[model samples]
Target: FVSMACSSSSFPLMVSISGVRGIACRSITPELIVKYVAAFAYLQITRHQKDLPITEKPEIVLLRDSRVSGEWIERISAGVLQSMGANVLSCGIQPTPTAQLLALQRSNAVGALVITSSHNPKEWNGLKFIDSDGLFLSPESCDVLFQMVNNSAYQYPSFEQRGSFVDFADAAQIHIDTCTSLSYIDLEATKKRNFKVVLDSVNGAGGPIMKSLLETLGCKVIGLNLEPTGVFAHTPEPVPENLGQLCSAVVEHSADFGIAVDPDVDRCVLIDETGKPLGEEYTLALAVKFYLSATEKRGPICKNLSSSRVCDDIAKEYNCISYNTPVGEIHVAKKMVELNAIIGGEGNGGVMLPDVHIGRDALVAATLIVQLLSGFEGTISEYKKSLPQYQIVKLKAPIGNMVPELILADMKKKWEGKEGVTLTEGDGLRIDTSDYWVHMRKSNTEPIIRVIGEHQSEEEARKVCEQFMSEIQNWKAETSE
Candidate 1:
């Protein structure tokens, strides 16, 4: 019912402490990057001083995806941090997770800046901040830092106190080695299968590293868009519809499967052996299946509330407990740490293994999934059929004029007492039934409300979503009058 439905042309540059994303020189400019980076550096130095060594300024790591605009953002960011008397460890183009891992490697690192717009288009670029512990800043951290930026309370040191810059080139190798070294991965079994995989990197930062990773896993790798040229061949996001080339390449080569990574390489999507594009939601589900099968000790699993319920089903198969957090990588990762979870990530093709690294690593997800396929007796399609089947339908409407609380109240009044249905809210309104579920909430990154439904069939999921859409429209019309 909300009428301000923004199209791609009208979508605002998403800005937050997590990152500031926009088309270069439009919503995001060099000056804005400088101010934001300076503010972030200010907070890192002030709040994270507990781990500071004596007689030195705090160090921050800087890296970027393969976007053309990222080069300028990285240079501007490094300059701002340097101006603030903070040392910068400049890592050239790399995955967002690589930057996080490199930050953890440095004993004196206070934080890191990753210049990327993630899955956004070529013109979009932004800065993602990572804390000393190699995790994205929590919402609470973002709130505090945004306040400082808005108030212009950031610290700027004089010329005598400027910080120095150092280049670190071993980040990609380190990330690769660490993933292959995880105890949960079965290298011998994976190698024995000698799987042939088609990899689509979308001409982003993932190209070289993903090829290296696939080869290391002993698979015959067919590369598409392998160059880190920053010129996107298709939409940068690894969604099913955008991955026609990957699916076709898999069929043409008769590869065992196809793999795709987002621009930053933090998220991964897969295509089955049948040249079918598997939904991004299945990435974590498949990972969870492999992880629980590999280890006898099933501790805890974690995911965002909006993620597919297949994760919970997989955890149950291993007699493990699964926890849900709000829809954010930080929320899921933080909860995983707090609960000592074995693995956790969002449904958008991100898989976070605390054993390998705290952040989402597409490389790690691909490794585990290969291990799973290598050990299984059937094709990826057969393996997918073995799991509980569910189809999800997702739609978004603008958050115009209506208060979210009032809308949620109306929903509760309408459905709370329905037979065999239950309602709960942590990040949004979710109604769970015996065979179907629906979740409606505001998007964290965009100015819209998303309604997602999961049912046994596509038709069923669509029906549920359409039902809600009609109700919301009716409610909006009434409120306007």
Candidate 2:
């Protein structure tokens, strides 16, 4: 909640637990990439050397999405790691989840670096750092890396001591094989359904692999923006507003459903058989319902604070525990590991199945959705109707020199002891009521406060979110005065 204004020189370069992102060539330059990569490489080398033999070099897996600048970032990152005496396994044009899986599968790998801005526009690119556990770096680890980057406290090896690089071409196939082999995926049954699906990958890294997965499962795939040309046909985010084409395609093609994934393929959003978006929040909720119903495994479910309450309702139906963490994949993943949760993810169409890997993966979510619908006795829309339904409205407010913590403090006081009101202030201020819940938190990657509210009705959700936004604006005006 600390107010840190961006200087003109670094207007949009965002460094956070989510990783560093900004408009390419402007804020996120080659020099910035080199510094961050070198810092990350140095941190990994130091961390691994503490437990392994000094003679052995740390292996780092490098992957990138299909952004035009991704190749440039990859080359610079690989060279930086190699220069620091870390061997690089370069997996070209793969999704973030694929790189995470590779990092986990490679016994010798010490860490990983993915060059992608995720769902950001094509002009934007950034870096996501993964630890040896195939998870995003924890907040503490990121703090240390940022400190090193700020201080330029990394080392370079001698010419002869520099490490080697290898071009790895098996990442996609390996990821596909692992996903197709999951016990939750009834391959033969899914194939027998012979579902027709429309897939829009936004010409990012998921196109070829997602198409391949559906075809392997015997699905007739209608592909759009599948060329990985780094030129997005529309806004890259797979939200309802950005997915009109996918929705229309689903209805136009008489498909069973439509699927859209972000640039790095970690988020999955779906359109129903009738060409209606199922809402990004339902992605995780549907996955939770399917996992709990389809398997004998009964454990806790974890999601971010901003996720839908329907997930909790689904867990309650199964007599399972549900935990809510701060808004980040690492937090949810760590909580899942601690609780041995069956599944966890963010509400932004990210689904993390521990059985697959502890990362939000579109591939995993898509597979689960396909299987869930294939086994259901009705259409995709009907199946959605069967699940617990909720409406969520998400809006952003500009900070404008107003401190987020101060705004949250006022909100906490305003609702501290109201009837059935509960306030959570760990990551941000979240006010929970019997009917709906509203969360206001600072954006990790943008200079704004995200105000999210969910209720059984869409109008109520929008009203609650707008109320908070109006209050924030009032506070900003007062601050200006």
Candidate 3:
């Protein structure tokens, strides 16, 4: 919700509902890490002790991604938790979802902290706090934690009362086992197909577990950037432009398809057999279709305002209603639980299955993709072609001195009471027309305004985005004048 734009010379730290992120050694120093961790631990300890016996110390699951500073961050984070009289269950170099699942499974665990920048460049590092229910902190909880940080409201326990630390090495395998054990997976049938997959982990935390999961499901893996070095092979967003290498490799190896995951392995993208990237929006659409077709249990579907409308189309086909919340995985996940949604996720290749735990998980997404492909007679691209098609264009504009709220307020006024245009406000401004929709919101992870437009065709989507981008710029100009 913070609108201050991020720049190297200006404020480099980004703390929002998503978590805290900044350039390593610059804005995210050891002191900053300790302060945040201590505050989080204190919050968890006080919040949970009331529900439990007095003798029990709150347990926290701590993990990290493949950033170069992850190790030291983990050490400092663990030390802070221990000093605050909270036991630390350290799972070194595991995906963010894995840590969330572990936290949910541990009955004594009150929360978790993941040291990851999650698809950011290697120079960035941060923390993602997960509550006992295995979801990110809600907005209200985040406000309380930030207040605690600002007030310096943390206390350390005596030396004898400090908590213990233990290493948990089986977290990745546990996540794989959970994914394969799902009844809908049909691992044996998928294994019979003997899929040839080209996996690109970009040398992040997902490399080992993703490869292991594919092979366990009887895939012939052609690994790229499999090592968990902090250095990435390319930009780590897993977008189309950043995945040229994976596309070429899939064609060169003549593989069935290629799979790409972000650094934390929460988002999953695919390259078809023809060496073409399926836009990230399709990851959720395909997963929803597959789940609906494969199961008899029907429920509502939830997605973010910025996600493609194809999900609504699919939901209607199955006689299920679809709901849209503000942008953020936690928002979607909470809505899913409220609606008992069978499946929900974001548009950025994040798929959340409540059965597998309420978090965006690449392992679950990849497993669904493999199982869905195994039953089909054609290639990946063909399967994508058969689904409801829509073009989604995502663009960002810098929010210079102008306030995002004022701009969004103006947009609401401009589009309000139009023929078929409906405006949705709260997180940002979303204008839904008869043919298309455009959502403008402040980025939770970065310092800019994210403009997402979707329509039946690429041209129309781009046009809508450009029109709105021009309008926003003009507003800034008028304000300056």
Candidate 4:
């Protein structure tokens, strides 16, 4: 069934909870979506209350991006939720964060089901479970959902017992209003300055929200794939290569800055005012600067190991503790809880501002960026100028022979005497040096081993990776020889 996800292969359709992905029918069918959603609803309902309220059926927040398959999944999943005696509130084409925020705001509900693959391709689709507190499902809850999915316990009730449906259009508006008002930038000033900004939303949930938020923020925004059509113009990852259009737009229009959000508006990468693709790593860093500037509160900060080291500097500068996790929003969120992080997220432009919400919100990302630039009294480039410059070189290796356990063991053994620094084991291996750090990870979503290194010079960073790869290759050679 995994072959079905490959473009060149045709295989029988099936669903297992690595979470659903790929084309709507060939990979993720309506039946699959319905069953998964129903199973999740069952799990949430049972876990929340020991005694089920007969009249007050458990309510669930249903949300989706602009993917056409989202329509199919939403309708089928809603039917399944209602069938499972759960009240359904549909928030159409909203960012994942909006749904999470709404679910927490409307705390009467059990949890939220977001129909998005996050940064996945146009053909791909997924369901991200958000807890009552507006974060990814806890491990205990996820396990329950997995059990329900596997046991085939998601059954619909009789006609009369079937749960009712209600239109929840205001959920999106409410989220938007909250974000626009929270640490919000002055739209009037942005407009008065005639700020020209280029926005590339990758035709996902970010489209509608970015357009609305930017317009309201008073920027003459030029948007690529402005419609929430889910027809992704390129890879929806918001990486540097996919951001050429945005960079070009900024330069061509002489826009003040360029913003790019992933498929769902949970992450926002940026381009400087000069059309320079600043890369996604800076999004979290920039957001931290803005957030702390807006508020004097300081505590622990959390991020994945693969995130930029700029966070380390920010945390140290602010006299706050910084913790690194493996990856995934759930992992970061967990660390935030432990560290009581004031802010947290990944290097992929997903800034988790706990004050606004625990999850990533690209709308919040946009508003903060706008407000930061407006308050700075200078351009984005000028603001970025104050930060240290480092060139990051990225390379990928196959994960087949490069087992994570083996890699971590070898790394620990090798780096034992080099330099003593903090280390953690969840994703792969990360070692902080006096001047630079290298994070080697096996991508959870992709079948590749990514080696990322950052240093003062490109040559230095690239050489470090090459040397590490050489050592790895040597180790493999010796192991086999």
Winning model by lDDT: 3
User: lDDT of all predictions, in order shown?
Assistant: 0.85, 0.89, 0.91, 0.76
For candidate 4, lDDT tens digit of each residue in 293-362? 7788889999888887887787888888788887777788888988788988888788887777888788
In model 4, pairs of residues that clash are 187-217
In candidate 4 the C-alpha lDDT for residue 433 amounts to: 83
Question: In model 2, which residue pairs have backbone atoms overlapping below 3 Å?
Answer: none
Better of 1 and 2 by TM-score: 2
User: Which prediction has more favorable lDDT, 1 or 2?
Assistant: 2
Q: In angstroms, how far off is 300's CA in candidate 2?
A: 1.1
Off by over 4 Å in 1: 1-11, 398-405, 473-481
TM per prediction? 0.94, 0.97, 0.97, 0.90
Clashes of each: 0, 0, 0, 1
Q: What is the C-alpha RMSD of each candidate to the true structure, in Å?
A: 2.9, 1.6, 1.5, 3.6
Quote the positional error of residue 286 for candidate 2 in Å.
1.3
* Residue 394, model 3: Cα distance from true site in angstroms: 0.6
411-476, model 3: which lDDT tens digit per residue? 888888999888898789999988999999888887788899999999999999999999999998
Error of 1 at 140 (Å): 0.9
